[model samples]
Target: MTRHPGTNRTAQCVVCGRAFPLPKLRKIGQLRPGLHEMIAAEVADCGAESLICDEDLAHYRRRYVEKLLAEERGELSELDRQVLDSFEKGVSTVQSSAASVLDRNPTFGERTADRVASFGGSWTFILFFMGVLFAWMALNVSGLFAVPFDPYPFILLNLVLSCLAALQAPVIMMSQRRQEEKDRRRAENDYMINLRAELEIRQLHEKIDHQMAHQWERLAELQQIQIDLLERRGDTQRG
Candidate 1:
């Protein structure tokens, strides 16, 4: 937040030609005292004395990032393209949970199957059904009804059990199939997330490398500037 002295308090941007507050404009000198000269000489051609507005600065930053990525990856993937696009557009790359989105719109059959599978797999169902079977046997064998509805071998009970089994097996299988599908989708989402994260990390490394190289170059230039200044002082003092 360095303040620059100006009567009008406005500076015209070299790139866009728009007037912005002197404090708001990023002076070419302020970017990097040494590297700015190289950038102005090599890339921007602005002669080391220029001002850029926030918009143009952002544009240059994005271009720098893209250049680094291009040099590293050689070609952009769709995912890489999307990530760079998001950076340029100032949009967030993070996404909502895919599992939540998938769960939000379940069909009636899916819901029913899940519920049936959960209930059928529980100990409560097992214990209650066992109790019912015991009661049926007791009532028939004790002759509580004068004539047993299911005689000794319990043929009627066997038919009921067979029908229940026939129905429950399919419901559990349907639920398991839906679960497998969900797991597959979740794995795909996880892979995508991990890939995106790796790309971002790689891009970040590129940025850091670019900055380190730029800083090293800048340091060399600063040392040269200091040497020239000392030489000039020595000559002036001798005179």
Candidate 2:
């Protein structure tokens, strides 16, 4: 109950047992019921009239959110942990650039596979490969080559096509695997951003509700004081 010099009034925090100015203290009653329950679960002696400093209140708010998330999800994943950490730190969960996530300094082989897969899927590669096949057949069948390297059956050409297919399949698969990994990371990032936004909105709603409740209480007190003053005036006039 010791007052800070020059301050009108001060209240001591029940959790931390540190005195703070009235403006810096929050009543347990003003908190949302869920948040109050969280604090009470930790501090057995806390009640509706108990005061908590803003810092302790913030800590309990974070714990309440963490408990809510854990209850809803059961087991927290790495992504969920990251979201909670960011929420506690009051930092943004949004990635600065999504491309940075996709481009995270890929290895030489990965880059090459991606490029090969991309080219192989394009019309340019298809048309060019078709033209090469036609020219090889024309050269062998039209007697353009003195002794055809690949004869009418074109066994050598068949071998080359088979080799190309074998090499291309695995490369495309590797590229696809890398793409799937990138997509998974992007999804995690999106989820974290969305979760952060939702937490912020919930906090905002809690603050508005707290303010409204506090205002109503102040108004009720003022009305009671006015009624008391009017009663005193009536008694005085009657006298």
Candidate 3:
């Protein structure tokens, strides 16, 4: 191929056999160097020394990810399915606020039940109720009323107390049920977040392992090259 004298460095893509600017191509030395040899001749006809375009790189990346998934999880779980889908789509995996999930709009009854439960379980409510009971008994005993509306047995007070207990019990129970639901939702959210984090960490480990292996191979190649050069130098000096 002919090129302008001022044209920047170009690379011949091994897959398409087309020349592109260096910026548009990735060096085999930088990527998985082993991949250059594994590449099918039909798709990429190149020797050991080759470069790949962005399109070919993406294809190989997808293949690598699939291989990892198949090896790690024989049968995909729900979390695994989600992670693989996100990986394929190149989507971000992040955790949203689990605590804030309770912010959903609640019905009037739910709100009222929560408030009533909270108040009924407080010391202020108990103190106020005790004071009212004491005042009622004092008034009846002192004969404050012309006929002491509620006499010694205070049957009216007993009836009022029973009615209050019946109503408060259900309200408190309703509030507790709602709280249990929220806790369950939070637990589910936390589990998803933790599972995703674990998957991402595993993915990172795979990438790092691949990179380290490649680096070791490259270092060995470099060391061999240096040894060959030194031998040649000694030969020349002896002559």
Candidate of highest lDDT: 2
Model 2 misplacement above 4 A:
1-30, 44-58, 95-103
Q: Please give, for residues 15-86, the per-residue lDDT of candidate 2 as tens digits.
A: 988878888887897788888888888886788888888778767777788888889889778777778777
lDDT of 3 by residue, 100-193 (tens): 6587788999999999999999999999999999999999999778999899899999999999999999999999999998998677666656
- Residue-level lDDT for 46 in candidate 3: 55
- Winning model by TM-score: 2
The lDDT for every candidate, in the order shown, is 0.74, 0.85, 0.72
Candidate 1 segments whose C-alpha is farther than 4 A from its true place: 1-101, 236-239
Q: What clash pairs does model 2 have?
A: none
RMSD of 3: 5.7
> Model 1, 142-173: lDDT tens per residue?
97898899989999999999999999999999
The clash count of every prediction, one per candidate, is 0, 0, 0
lDDT for residue 183 in candidate 1, whole number 0-100:
85
RMSD of each: 6.5, 3.6, 5.7
